[model samples]
Target chain A: MPQPLRYLQIFATFARNSLIRDMTFRANFLIEFISSLSWVFMNLGFYILIFHYTPSLGRDTGWGKYEFFVFTGTALMINSLAGMLFMTNADNFGELIRRGGLDFVLVKPVDTQFLVSLQRVDWSSSGNFLVGLGLAVYSLRCLGVWPSPVTIVLYVFYLLCGVVILYSLMFLLAATAVWLGRNETLFDFWFYIVSFGRYPMEIYEGRFGRPFRWFFTFIIPVLVAINVPSRFLVQSIRPQSLEEWLLPLYTIAATVIVFAVCRAVFQLALHSYRSASS
Target chain B: MAAIEIRGLSKTYRVTRKKEGLVATLRALFRPEYEYVHAVRSIDLTIESGEFVAFLGPNGAGKTTTLKLLSGIITPTSGEARVLGHIPWRRENAYRRRFALVMGQKNQLWWDLPAAESFHLHQQIYGIPPDQFTRVRDELTEMLGVRQLLHRPVRELSLGERMKMELVAALLHSPQVLFLDEPTIGLDVVAQYTIQQFLREYQARTGTTVILTSHYMKDVVVLCRRVVVIFDGQIIYDGSLTNLVDHLGDYKIITIRFSDGQVPTDLSRFGKIILREPPRVRLRVARNEATEVIRAVLARYIAEDVSVEDPPLEELIAALFASARNSRLSQERGNSAVPEDTTHSANH
Candidate 1:
């Protein structure tokens, strides 16, 4: 069989096995699914309350209640997809290091990165993804300006790019477990970093926020992950500046660079892995 | 070509040196003293294909570390090794595909899922054909008597059952080289014997090069013909298992069962009386004198049964480790004047 086909087959098997594993603990799975959905719903409620008093999220930013909702929906989908695919696996990386479960992974014929990154899928996160999709469609209908076919395709492509960026970031943090022994603090860092991506990049444009905007945009590239994809779906927003026009290309470039860097770091970390003594 | 070849392969780890007590803990929290641990040091070894070699050593003797290095689970700090003409530390897919490593303590299978699910995942990962995968999986499960347990959640299975499933997972790829690290670490005698029998049969049929590190002497004795004893991160002895006895075991144990409580008096005249029950007595005699001692005992007492056996491999190995430690201690004492290097090196 061809290599790519074999990897796809492996990933399919992994997804199926993860579903089986999740189904084995039926009540826990349901509770997790409900818990994730409740979080998304509560966040949406908070936004709804805020929108009641304001015409737009920011002054002269053209992000109306529904527009910002679209952005929020994009963020939700991207985060949910990332959570579904890599969250559990990345969270378990430290445990794998501590318990030496990685030794078997390293010995497999499959790519170590592929095996470690996609071994387990958090199916519960799919609930949040469906909710995010509902919010996006509802917001689009409320706005009464549906995106073109080309725009939708571009939006989906950029949404996938966003997911990849998030995966790469989480993976890079997880890879540190090899050196740090226990990197439970990485989730704290992740929450802090991903929080910035939840809001519009325009909100971080003042004196204090400019530096953060610049840092997250160019250095970490988290801001552009959701911002550019949201721009594609929110038809009212048009790219007027050269930087804005290049944002989509920049997100694509960042996704590729960040993913490549993460893969390289993961491999380097594997070289350093001392696999807890048997 | 040899299945495995290593030249001066060494692995040194920089581990934190923690002192006890509040002051020391605080000092360590700030200053953090570290020391180097030579896990595997300056060792060279070669094993041909289809050879079942047992790596015997006490804890921290680098047996598992050596296996990890050979299987590409970890890189060596210095030197080089090639398993099947590929540098193991390079971790090429081709090299990885042809080799398998089974650790008894770790579960590669998903805990909540059945062993069959994990087996299917392995088939996809290794790209084993459907027919070949089924054949191999069925054959392994049958031989290990785990066919019924395949559908049970791995967490629900007993340790022995889980270990059998782990073996099946490791062997699904039909690897040409197998590395087993303490594969019978926590198992009952029956389970251990079953695995030992399976491994013996599998290695015979597959012609796979097998390197196993096991503390269980029974595993080593039953499954391996060649034994390599490691001590202090060094290869202390490497030869056939039988020769290991002939070379280090100087004594033989003789057991005589006297007829109807007619036990001999003054048994010390014959040899060192190890066991002195009423009708049955066991004596430890020099290997050269074992036959004469047994003959004399038999002639003197109406022996219903007589048996002569070499000293247990466990005792011989323990003695080997003690002697090696003593020599190492003396060598360290002789070199006490040398300055110790406290500088921490980069962990590999």
Candidate 2:
């Protein structure tokens, strides 16, 4: 079989198995879905309260209440999809290292990164994904914007780029657990970094915010992930600057670079894994 | 060609050292101490295809480390090893597909899903053809008597049942070489025997080269004709299991049943009194002195029956380990018989 076909087959099996596993614990699975949806709702409610006081998120940022909603929805979709696919696997990578579970993975005739990253899907995050999709469409409708077919295509493609970026970043962090031995702080650091991507890059324009924006935009590329994709979908808004217009291309470049770097680091870490003795 | 050929293969781990007490903890937080542990000292070994070899050692003697190195789970600090014509640490996909490693303490199957689900996942991961996968899976499940438990969640199965499933998963790929690290750890006697029987029969049928590291002497005795005894990361003895006994077994057991149901009063004069019941007494006599001791015992008392036999394999192995420790200790100290204080465990 071709390599891609083989991997796709394995991934399909993994997804099916994960769904079965989730259904096996119906109560816990339902509770997780409810919990994720509740968190999204509360976040949306918080933004709604903020919009009531101010017409836009920031002064002259062009991100009106509904426009900002689009950005938030894009972020939600990106995070939800990434979390559903890679969150549990990345979080468990550390435990795998500590418990020597990775030994089995190393012996399998498959790409270690692919196996480690996509082995388990968090089905609960599907609820959050739906909520994000609803919010994006509802906000687009409220803004009275109908994007062109090209814009919609670009938006979907960039959303995938956004997901890949987050997966790469999370995988990079989890791979560090191999050397650190125990990286319980991985999610803590990830949460902090991802929080920067939640809001629009416009909010970061002041003396202190400029460098933060530059760091997150060009260096980490988290800002461009959701911002560019959401910008493409919100037809009423147009790129205000050359840099903003080129953000989509930059996001694509960043995804490729980040994923390649993650693969390299994960391989290096695997070489250093001292499998725990039985 | 040799299924495995290891030359001076070694693995050294750099471990952090922390002292006890709050002050030491604080000090370590600032300036941590570190030391190197030689998990596998430079050792050379070779095994041909279809050979079943047992790596016997106390805990931390580098048996599992060697297995991991062979399976390509971890790279060695130094030296070289090739499994099936591939350098293991290179981790080529072709090499990985041709071998499997199973650790009894760690599970590869999904905990929340049925074993059948994991088996199907394995079929996809290994890219096994549908017909071949079904045939192999059925054969393994039927042989292990786990066909009924395939649909049950793995967590719901007993330890023995779970281990049987693990074997099926490992064998589904039809690996040319199998590495088993304490595959029967933490199991009842019945379970252990069942697994041992399955492995023996499977090896016989498939002719796959297998290297197993097990603390259970029974596992070693029952499955392996070739045994390698390692101590302190070095191979101390390697040969047939029968030869291991012949080389280190210095004592025999003598059992004497008295005509009257009365215990011998001075049995120690002959040899170590291993057992002393009212009617029968067992003695551990030097192998060379068995004849004289038996003659002395028969003349000294009215015996109903007498028998002689080799000591249990466990005792011989324990004595071998004890003698090796003594010799090492004696060499370590300026004295001729300085023994290191490190613990040596024979879990069996």
Candidate 3:
């Protein structure tokens, strides 16, 4: 079916107005804004404390230890963008289905899936992205080097991949509403997984942690979005050969497959929805 | 030729069977028993093109279920049906684009935006050409008399106004078929009449095939000529509305008016007395017996006038269902698990 352009315009208008309405609750907005800033400060505070205790990467590793710590933290900051932006949609879709708000979408001419998943944007996430960028730039200055123009461009591409992996996995989880009904525990467990993508995969030094980061970096592909960019900007973090960049290459293919599967599962859920009886 | 063909169509829903309580819920979570409720049983029906058919039934009598099947909202458990030469449940976009379903209990209009936004949305969803979209949208608005309501938020409109706007949204694409489930429900008489009038004119102008289910007999009386009466998921009556009235020999009310405001002192000897006001009311009489009964009343009592009326449509429907219930009782009483009428409809 052709996209409903005017309807989408109206939908965006509604979403914008709703966001503005939330901003009107001055106390709540103030609370959330402060809490989110504090959250970023807390994550970095823990990192600086850890660096104070170990000075170098296991005392025998090659790169500047502080540079390594800050860069790995940059990966965490970029990955948080997924939480900051797309997570809201993934979280809301399952509830929307259970609540019959999905009926509102189905009666419309638009593809119900598109409306449900992208219906709202968390404009507040602009705060998380800015703070994260500032941290990355500060970490670069600590190394006394400027990232090449190519490195900056590669960072943006990786960020886009990060969003896709997040979107596809969330869509996959929300699609479970079709069979099991709404299960929010599955969605919360996803946020817990994002925490693992915070550091360099090498931190734990054991096979277990290696496979864990590898699962997220390749199988799920979220870690790649973060690790690839942070690895590039910090320079000594990534493998130096063209062949070692294969993981990021694998990410694009996996992103496509995840998206196709999400689309299929979401459509199946729509078909099975039994609307309320009169 | 038939525009719709339903052959041995049956639909059933599985309802979990368990006692009501948290304990039962937990127990059932592990080992649940389910009972099947046959919402619509195996039944064959055919509807020809350009026909306005009123589907009538008591609550849970499967009228809306049948309409849902015809509209492709739910797939049947068995058998097959076709609308406009397409299978509905497959939900091919082209087949979906050809028909519209208007449910009275739900609104397709966006609640916060002006109704026009939804119309434009339909324009894109159906891929309607620009010129045709404008022409049809304007024509529907004018016909439904909602030209002034285009700019108002749907939530602000009165029930009648909202319903008119809903009709405009449903018809913005000018579908060839319309399936309406209780389109006149919960509306004031004026609003109902306005909708009924608009529907009649729309059908007359476009010759669109309309299948509507309404509890209000007045709606069916004004809109549909042929009535399909379903009871217990079976099409017990299908033919002209007038014919069903005649063939369903149930009850007819007869009343007599006398110059002196007094009923005949003895009504029991004449017939069953239903109303006891000054002018007497008696139970309905069959055609053959009504003539003899009327003569006896005339000979024995003095009256200024007399009138015969068919029982209210609602009452007639209730009587049909009551009879169905009694038959089921008898079958259970006799413990007859044997199916009835297997020999009928030998062709299919």
Candidate 4:
């Protein structure tokens, strides 16, 4: 039908084929799925132990047990989206370049970036995503905060924004593999950067924290990713100032800018690509 | 119009050089040495549409590099090329849809998925209509005799069966031009013959321009009429295969079997003696002198059997490269005569 619809259809086919491939190694898939979910549960347990002694993350920062759990859930959701969609492909991008697998990708009639970024679907990562959703609903219920449908819709919108930001950052890191030849440290670096978003932004409010907060909030924008969406759910609990209400707009703008810049970087890397000799 | 054209096309890569040993490896991590490798030098050529041409070369002889440049897999270091009226490196979708590059050592199909699944993916990627996809896929699989293997995972198939499936995947789009880089490599004689027969029939039916790079001489002799030989990143010869044999192969091989009890004392006047057995002798005679040499041998000896034939293409090609190397060495030495020792080294 239409071009965009055709691409979506192709993406669906890729997802279907990936699932079939995964089914071929069903035992390994189950192991990975269980391991991923275990990590989510372990994190939840660690935070529950912390909430045992502290009333809030910061004395006056309004981050109580349920509020912080909401933030944790939002971070997990964003990370899982990225992990499912781009992690496997990005991790394999270096090998593809090194072993000349990208030559086949470059010759395809579809968009190179689109195909490379979305070719593999990690269905196992969705386990963490479902767990994250459950935590978010559980925390919302614990807070006795029944969000309106509009608030829930806004939460989903901002959750997508968070995923887009994470994807752009991960993609940009993966694109560097073209020049670096091999970047095995990319996942380590990605986890380090994303760990900052796992907690409430209020944790970074002191002397050294001020600049860290400002840098992540404005430059990398990871702080805003989970903060805005988690805050959208508890808007009544912590009423928003004008600037707080404008966070969604800022998230949109950041997503557009980061997406465009990363896309350009990826294209420039592809232009400089000297394929491995056969 | 020519389906493919190239002038001064080249590719140079900056290769990192590292020394052996742990200390040097550690030092290289801080500061690595670099050298420029000219994979393909200035080369000029053109091929008409629907022409099947063989690109023959030894290892590291720039055959694959030229194909990558023409297929838009990699950009050139300098110069220009146009395929089907479009610069290949520009990589417009329309251009890509009309051409296919199949590398024997690399695969596009997913390892865990069935070949049929990959075919469907190609149909989507190329935006092929369902009917056209099915017809082309069935025709190719049927021709290659691989219809039964399409539903099995690609990893489980043998190399020859996998290669046939790869060909089917590449050709399902009905590309107007096909670039095959060593398609029949590492295959048994029967498998190679099967691929060759299918290629010949496919070329005849569709008139697609095919440029194949193969180490197998039989693939070239059976499928392509024209051949381009490359050495040291340059085009050394380009003409019909028959012309290649005529131009470089100037001698014929003559084998003579004498009656059991008879032996010729001297046959030097007839030709250069290549082999000598008690009752049989082989000689390399100049093409023009072959008839006269045979006449003289028959007159001088009682022959039970006699056979005269052109040397195999493999020998002709080895001789061509050895001679080319010899000339290059002589030119480097600033002499008109090749050293006798160097000739032995070249032959080996």
Candidate 5:
């Protein structure tokens, strides 16, 4: 079989395994679904609180677009990325590598990087995904921005870019297990970064913060998940000169670059994994 | 052509020599001197396809390091190895897909889920087609008698059950090459035999190339046709089990049953006595003098019954290691015949 076909086969197999994994614990899925739904409602209340204190983001106020502001951007971004993959899935790979559980992947005839990254998925997070998309649609109706077919396509493309960026960044961090030996703290550090993704990048300002934001821009570009989709909703928004071609193109380009770098690092790391003796 | 070829395979590990403590760890973190432990010295090996080979060694003998190099788990520091005509460390997906490595101490199964769930996940990871997947699963689980154990969570299974389940998981994809490290560790005798039987049958059916490392002699003796003995990061012996026993077991065991209340004569000059009780005298006699020794003992003691037999493989292995270590000690001490402690393992 062609190599590309094999990659797709591996991907499909991982995805199918994820489905079986979720079905394996039918009861846990229900409990987790309820827990995720409750978290979504709690976040929506937090979203409403953000606009309540700032009239600039309140309905009918001068900059009145809280519905568009909150859902199409911050709240929607959180929910969408939450379901793309679990934070634990990234952490588990590192632990697996340290524990020698990853030898199974090394001996198999599949891309270790692909198998490691996509092998496991937390199905419970699909609850967060569904709720987030529902809220995004409801808020879009409230803003009277139903999205043209073109905007919808762009939304998916950017969303995919955002997901890829996050996955690649986390994978690269997990790949550090080969060198660092224990990537537990690093895995937690990435999830901590994900928490920061819940807000717009404009909130923080520091000379050092620019590099921090650069991570979301040049490195992972979670900014694309929010800023681009928000542009489709805000009527007054305009693509500043180069931002038009540059942002999406950079998002796509960055995804490819991060994935390529990850693949290279992963191969280098595999060379270093002397199997555990104890 | 060699299906697997390793030339001058060497591995060195950077290990901290200090004991673990807060003070020691902190100081070591900043300016620690890492001792380069040569886990595997320059070693050469060529294994043909479909060979059931045992890679045996005492603790830290570099047998596992060699397997790691062969399976692409680790790169040799200053050597080259090829498995199925590919550089292992490159880890081409094609290469990985064709082989499976099972570490006895570590598990590949999901902890909280049934073993079947992990198997399904494995199927997807290997991209085993549905029909082949079903056939392999049914046939392997059937042969291994793990059909009843499949639905239970791996954490809930006994160690033996878990080991059996691990084999099913490893072989479910039908890997042409298998690297098994102490696969029968922590298993009951029956479970070990069950696994050995499955491995023999699997090898016979698929012609899979196997490289197994174990402290257990039965696993190597029963499953492997060829044995490679490694000591101190070198392949000292590479041949067959019968040859191993024959070459090292050149002495026969003499157990003489004599009449009660009779002390046996000082027969130390004749041979090395291994055992002496009230009415039993065991001697280690050369193969050529066994008949004469037995006649001499029987005539002298009016023995009830005398038996002569070959030593156990374990005993021969122990003697081989003891003599090897003794020779090395003599060399190190400049032929002083150093009176070193031999009450314990000479290799130790």
Candidate 6:
């Protein structure tokens, strides 16, 4: 078998093993799944109550009730994908470093980054992802917008781009654990940054909001993650000008660049690692 | 060819110094002080293929650090080493696939998963064929007497049982070189004996080169023919185990039993009285003077039985470390008048 195919096979094995491990604690898994879905439902309910007073998020931004739901759904999908794939592993990376558990990982013949990032799979997070996708489809129907096959394909592609961006960002934060010894606030910081990406980018148009929007859009590019994918779903909300079309292209480009940079940073961190002993 | 070779291998670490109190903690956040700790000093040694060598040292004497350097878990600050002609720190996949390192305190097995699952993971990581994997796995588990616990979660196993499983998992790849850092640590007497017996047999059968570090002298005495004693990050002694006892252990214990159940008051004239019981007394006699001391004792007192034996390896090693430490302290104090005895003992 080829090298890449062998890695995929190993990943499948890890997923299966993780499933078995999770199944051993059936009650805990169920509680986590239900709690995560409840959070998503509460967020949806909060937005629905807010839309009752205001017809749209912005006076002329066209982010009415259903359009905003699409954006919220896109945010949920991206966050859930990231939470399933790398959240738990990233959260535990510091403990592994401090306790010298990484010694075993380093000695293995497989790629250390691949093994650490994908070793654990949380099946509970998949529940939120499925609900998010359902909301996206439901909202699109409520708006009476039947997107063409091409538009749906583009939306899915951009959704994947959002997940890649979030994964790279969280991975970079986790890699800091190697240098800092313990980054206990990584999840809190990540949540704070990601919460900004939950709503439409046009909402940040005030004096402080303009700079915040510009910074997050160009520097971190979290705004483009949900905005481009959600906008592509509705005809009226889609990019009208050629410059607007560049947003999706820019999201792809930023994802590639950020992923490459994060991978390099992780390698550098490993090189500088001194095993836990003196 | 030598299975392992080293040239002035050294590892220095920068350790941050933290002072107590809130003020110091706050100040450290801005500027921290660091001290250089030479965990492994420049030392050189070599071991031939299929050699079973014991690495003996006191706590914090750099035994585990040296093993870590050899296993490529941490890079050295200077110097070089090669195992089977491959630079260890380079950590090539082909090299890693041929060697294994097991640390007693640190576990490689997944806590929530069964040991068998971890064994399968190792199979994939090492790229072992299915048939060979099963064969090696069964053989190792059988030898370790852990075949029944293969499917049980690792967190539920007893320490000894878990350690057996760890050994089995490590050997599943059939690694050519094994670096065991305190492999029998924290095990009961029976468990330690079991592991030692299995290791002895396994090394004999496979001709695998093994370097083991242990505080348990029994592990060394039972399995290793050659011993390397390290002190203060340097090789202090390297030779056969018998030679080690002869070189460092200059005294033997002589136990005497009185026929009439009477204690001798002046037995100190024979040798150093180490112990005394109702009808039995023990004396520490110099190795060269044992025969004369026994002769004098026999002539002076009517003894029913007598036995002469070397001091336990544990005691001998502790004495050696104490002597080494004293000499180092004297040297540090610039006490030129104090003669250094450790060098002379090693030469003998």
Top candidate when judged by DockQ against the true structure: 2
lDDT (0-100) at residue B235 of candidate 2? Answer: 95
DockQ of each candidate, alpha-carbon based = 0.85, 0.88, 0.27, 0.79, 0.54, 0.63
What root-mean-square deviation over C-alphas does model 4 reach? Answer: 4.1
Q: What TM-scores do the predictions have?
A: 0.96, 0.95, 0.82, 0.94, 0.86, 0.94
Per-model fnat list: 0.91, 0.91, 0.13, 0.71, 0.80, 0.55
lDDT string, candidate 6, B138-207, tens digits: 8988888989999999999999999999898889899999999899889999999999999999999999
Q: Given candidate 5, what's the lDDT at residue B257?
A: 79
Better of 4 and 6 by TM-score: 6
lDDT of each: 0.89, 0.89, 0.73, 0.88, 0.74, 0.87
Error of model 2, residue B66, in angstroms? 0.4
CAPRI classification of candidate 2: high
Put down candidate 1 lDDT per residue, B1-348, tens digits, no spaces.
Answer: 899999999998888897889999999988988788988889999999899999999999999999999988899989989999999878889998899998887878888889998999888877888999999999999999999999998999999999999999999999999999888888999999999999999999999999999988999988999999999799999999999899999999999888888776788987999998978899999999988987787677788899999898899999999999999877766665554632212221
lDDT by residue (A28-53, candidate 1, tens digit) is: 99999998899888999999999899
Question: For residues B1-348, what per-residue lDDT tens digits would candidate 2 score against the true structure?
Answer: 999999998888877786899999999888987767888889999999999999988888899899989988889988999999999988899998899888899898999889999999899888999999999999999999999999999999999999999999999999999999999999999999999999999999999999998989899988999999988788999999999988877888999999988877898988999888869899998999999999998898899999999888888878878887888665555442334432221110
Q: Against the true structure, whose TM-score is highest?
A: 1
Looking at model 4 chain B, report the run of 10 residues with the lowest lDDT sum: B339-348
Q: Tens digit of lDDT per residue, candidate 4, span A154-206?
A: 89998998988888888888889888888879756877888887777778978
True A-B contacts kept by model 6: 0.55
Q: What order do you get sorting by DockQ, best first?
A: 2, 1, 4, 6, 5, 3
**TM-score of the candidate numbered 6?**
0.94
How many clashing residue pairs appear in each of the predictions shown?
A: 0, 4, 1, 0, 5, 0
RMSD of 1: 2.4
lDDT of 5 by residue, A82-160 (tens): 4445455667777767777777677766666666776666666766676667766766777676677887787777666
The lDDT, on a scale of 0 to 1, for candidate 2 is 0.89
